[model samples]
Target chain A: MSQIFHPSTNTLSKVSIVSVVLLLGGLGYGLLALNRSPYVARTKIPFDQPVPFSHKHHVAGLGIDCRYCHTTVERTASAGMPTTETCMSCHSMIWTNAPMLEPVRQSWATGKSLEWTRVHDLPGFVYFNHSIHVNKGIGCASCHGRVDQMPLVHQENTLYMEWCLDCHRHPEKHIRPRDKVFEMAYQPPANQLELGAKLVKEYKVQKLTDCYTCHR
Target chain B: MKRLPWLLLIGGSMLMMGCRQDMHDQPRFRLNAATDLFGDRRAARPLVQGTVARGMLKTDTALWSGKVGNKNVDQFPFPITREVIERGRDRYNIFCSPCHGLTGHGDGMIVSRGLKKPPSYHTDALREQSVGHIYNVITNGNGSMMSYASRIPMRDRWAITAYVRVLQQSQNVKVSELTAEERRKLEGAQ
Candidate 1:
């Protein structure tokens, strides 16, 4: 049994132990990075639609109010997608023959839905209501970002529980005046935290972090 | 038996590498999501023909139809308050001002972009028209104007009608109607 293991074997065993620890740590870090990446979080990635609709042209160029198209946003659970009639309301006259708007014309002619791709998709378990947020001093820009600037809309934030918790835990960081909820270019004022604190009380926004608040 | 635990460890971890989305996307049709139950694949079914929801009977000829006995009434169904005028102004800016213009001048952004320009709201003919007539025009299409009934609710339509009157009064104000301060400001600007 003498000299079954060489002197170098002792160094090899110690290095092997250290290498295993390093490998596991690297694996854990990679998983977390992957979890928050664009692949999983779907942030900053634009989706393909049947027709490329430009929010920039419609919202910023035309100065149309969000409520003009999303009519039920203030009262409904989901912010309503505009109907074909809403599209044709203007396109019927203005962009009558634009090749890009042919799908809209066809949808109007056929009385069929345009099947606009949903941009903000949360998990089914999370029960988010647009009206409640809109009424509670949470501006549309707070979550949707500068939609007036995006030709093709993309998610601005990770729709992760941690991201949601960050806002729910401290809503005073983002709350705005109720009148400015639909205003796209609304900037948080210099005294944003102070104003938000006053608005949080006036709007009666509860720091609802209970699991059932969203899960149910 | 010794190798079975190692095999289970590797297999269990491998399965979890790709997180299951079944929980994320539960088996339910979300709003506007596609469905196979209908020919159109629309989960939101259209209202059955002639089916009226509760409190939506809409039998008031004056309020809902903007007509009484086949004539556009001259009176507003509800009294126009200052708050109502403000609400009307807000709603008017959103939906009507696109084509009607901010000051009822029929020179809105859309009109500039080549939609048939609507008539100015300050004309004597329009000034004499009843509020109900304007309400009727909004409810039903008039000329190139599409029916806004689907977009504006009944109350909002009246509010907008009231606001249209405000715009009319604002543009056609008589020189004598202005206060000394307002008269000076108007003359100074010119």
Candidate 2:
């Protein structure tokens, strides 16, 4: 042995043990942080669009109905995006010369569509239908949040699988009268559970937990 | 040998991150993205000739087209029920009420904001027109109005036509022709 190793070697081994433990703890935290990050969840982050259309100004300020622009929500699978014709139907007269609306004006003039960036984008495999949800008395505010309050639209909820399952498992907590679907300020009454049960039956909402329901 | 387990743990975590690429960057086509698989270089395939999609046969001329031959049918293809009228009211309020107003006065919120004014349903011109004529306008559109054929189904279009007639009658009713029950209600309000 002849004193070949330094006396500090004993302390060095102890330090290495502590470092290994800390590294494992850091990895666990990093995974948790990534899941909650804005990149993955995308809640409350306004995405950039070709035009900065404000839902607040149109919906809250002017009292325009959501169906006024998203015209096919009640009838089709997709809540159809407004065409240039829809924008020009109002902007052609009102705000005709505003520089802020230049992209809208150009789209109208060229007969080209404004490439709007989608906010609440689901993965390709998710089979979400706007008509089924809307026709079943699920209000616009149920998933979209208070869109009328947002100056620029943003995804308000996590829109995760767990979040959707929470509502699907207990739809009575969320269901409302069909007439109130567009009402952004609608609140579930004190007897919401009773009302929801009645609506769940009336709308024939089945408890959808099968993987094929959403995945297919 | 002591450091080997530590290195393996770090490498394993890194490998887990790489595995996420398969689901996120899946082998699939974006909507309307260009593809070389087809001669047209489009990802979407054109419908085959003589192939009809489900529920889109359009064989019923009066039901689907609002016409029998060249003329618009004077009556609804199906009987107009109370439930049908309510559905029509809902659809009309969502679609037509933006331009035609809830009462078909052509003074909708859009018109107040400066879109072209539609003709009032109570006008002599519109009131005298056949039910088919009104349905034709809704199916094909007329003047500044855009065709709602795609947005509204055939049954709903008929329902809306029925509701529009009800609106016209409401505004153009004669007091003398009112039933005794209706007259009593009107006098009670006074």
Candidate number of the best lDDT: 1
What C-alpha lDDT does candidate 2 achieve relative to the native structure?
Answer: 0.84
Q: Residues A72-139, candidate 1, lDDT per residue (tens digit)? A: 88888988888887887788888798999999998988877788778788988899889999999898
Off by over 4 Å in 2: A1-34, A37-39, A88-112, B1-19, B30-59
For model 2 the TM-score comes to 0.80
- Model 2's DockQ score: 0.25
DockQ (CA atoms), all models:
0.65, 0.25
Question: Candidate 1 docking category?
Answer: medium
Q: Tell me the deviation in Å of residue B117 in model 2.
A: 2.6
Query: Would you list the C-alpha lDDT of every candidate in the order shown?
Result: 0.90, 0.84
TM-score, every prediction: 0.91, 0.80
Give the clashing pairs for model 1. Answer: none
Per-residue lDDT of candidate 2, residues B17-68 (tens digit): 8657565445797544456787656576867998998988989888888789
Model 1 backbone overlap count: 0
